[model samples]
Target: MAEPILKVENLKKYFPVRRGLLGALRGEPQRFVRAVDGVSFEVYKQQVFALVGESGCGKTTTGKLVMKLLEPTDGKIYLEGQDVTELRTKEEIKAYRRRVQMIFQDPFSSMNPRFRIYDILEEPLLIHGIGETRAEREELIYKALEMVKITPPEDYVNRFPHMLSGGQRQRVAIARALILNPTFIVADEPVSMLDVSIRAEILELMKELKEKMGVTYLYITHDLSTARYFADWIAVMYLGRIVEMGPAKEVIDNPLHPYTRALLAAVPEPIPERKDVIKEIPIKGEVPSAVNVPPGCRFHPRCVYFKEGLCDKKEPQLVEYSHNHWVECHLAGKI
Candidate 1:
């Protein structure tokens, strides 16, 4: 494989939990929420590497850590061979952020309501000092707007975000992220807030941009089907750790971990001809709290294949089965 454009090794984030007044008076020790714990992955240039899991599974937190939106408790984040986690100065961080961008889940909230579409798109270039003159800024802004298919840029340029539809607003968001011509983008559930009818359109637009602009993406989402369709590589996270990861089709069609199988099973079946097919509930319990994670394998409490003393007593490391397929379950192949 080629060298990764971005890499995260042993990434960890622990948000401290404050104690109540009584607990503080009693001198209780401080607690922490292990939102993201020891997540490691690599994204090669122009590849869409997806992190998929249920809510509170730390996939979003992992994305934020990679984008430098949140500092990690312990880990290393490398962007184009530079360790961004070590960058402390404003100039260093500013230079590093120019190559990395993020498309948030909520399009409405991501953009400022006070600014015109043109201003929103031009802000990045101004901050980066890309366009010196007004004409240059306008040209870049229009080009970016057209890149996302918001044509007749003149009409949309003067208008505010409220005048646009949800789909159009998302396109503007994409344009804003692209105006800087970033090498890598972290799209955190980009299409989750859009209407189902337009979700495919937005996804296809992003895929097109990836090919046309040679931009790699870290697609964070909980939808397994979408991940299977949009990502080149898939990593299934469970309770702050990657339980499984491999090529998209191999992981989706031949899932090895119990948690992965459960996520796949939860996706609504689209086969209308197979109405008689019986579905099995793979997982039984709720996800555990991050502050008080299970002792050993986090999935043991809800896994159907849980063993008496083994799974509950030992934490399994991600082991390779086939060429690139990796799973963290003890019975990966045996089951």
Candidate 2:
């Protein structure tokens, strides 16, 4: 196998809890929200590796950490085998930004309503000092738009973000990221904001672009269905840690962790035979607050199969239960 284009080892990001003045004066112990507590994963060239979980599970924070948008409290991030944390100077970070790009969740919010599509797409090129002349940049912008199937770029480029459909705006956002010819892209819920009918179109376009451009991806999403359809590898995150990870097909079909099983059960089934069947979600309760993650197994409070003494007293290490399938749970293989 080829070497990984991106690698993250024990990635962690903790946001310190801000208590009021009285609480602080009282000498209350400081607390932290473990947004991403010890995530580790890798992505090979042109491979789509997905970080999947429900909202507030740290998947998005992991993507932000990889993009260098946020600093890690403790961990290492390597892009193409280079230590990303070592990039300190503005020039060094600028150079790094050119090689890595991000596609945000909300197209409407991520884009400037004031800027025209051409200017929006041109911003990255300007920042990276790409395409010296306006004509040259125009050509590149049109090419990127064409690549994303936005068509005849001249027509759309002249318009503002509000003038386009939700799908079109997202396509423009994708073009903005691709304009840099980045080595890796962090797509954070790229299709979650689009209409259900158009979600597949956008994903298909992204997959096609990945092969065409030879770019790898760190796809962050909560929808297992999309993850199953679009990603080669899937890592199921829970409260800030990966509970189950493996080949997308294997992890979804033969989930080892109770949390992973519960997630799979929640995915809407389309098969006619199972359409009317009432499926019981295995786990209980909403996701716990990150500030006060449960001890031992962070999921024990919500896990249906949690064993009292063993599950509450000891943390489970992520271990391989099968070939290339890693799970973090006391009863991984047994469950």
Q: Per-candidate TM vs. native?
A: 0.97, 0.98
Give lDDT tens digits, candidate 2, residues 1-335: 78889989999999999999999999999999999999888889999999999899999999888888988999999998999988899999999999999999999999999999999999998888899899999999999999999988889999999999999999999999999999999999999999999999999999999989999999999999999999999999999999999999999899999998998899877778667787899989889999999899999999988899999999989998999999999998786
- For all candidates in order, the CA lDDT equals 0.93, 0.93
Relative to the true structure, candidate 2 reaches a TM of: 0.98
Q: On residues 217-328, what C-alpha lDDT tens digit does candidate 1 reach at each position?
A: 9999999988988999999999999999999999998999999989998888767989888788699989999999998799999999999798999999988889999999
* Weakest 10 consecutive residues of candidate 2 by summed lDDT: 268-277
Task: Rate residue 118 of model 1 by lDDT.
Answer: 92
Residue pairs with colliding backbones in model 2 are: none
- For the record, the alpha-carbon RMSD of candidate 1 to the native fold, in angstroms, is 1.2
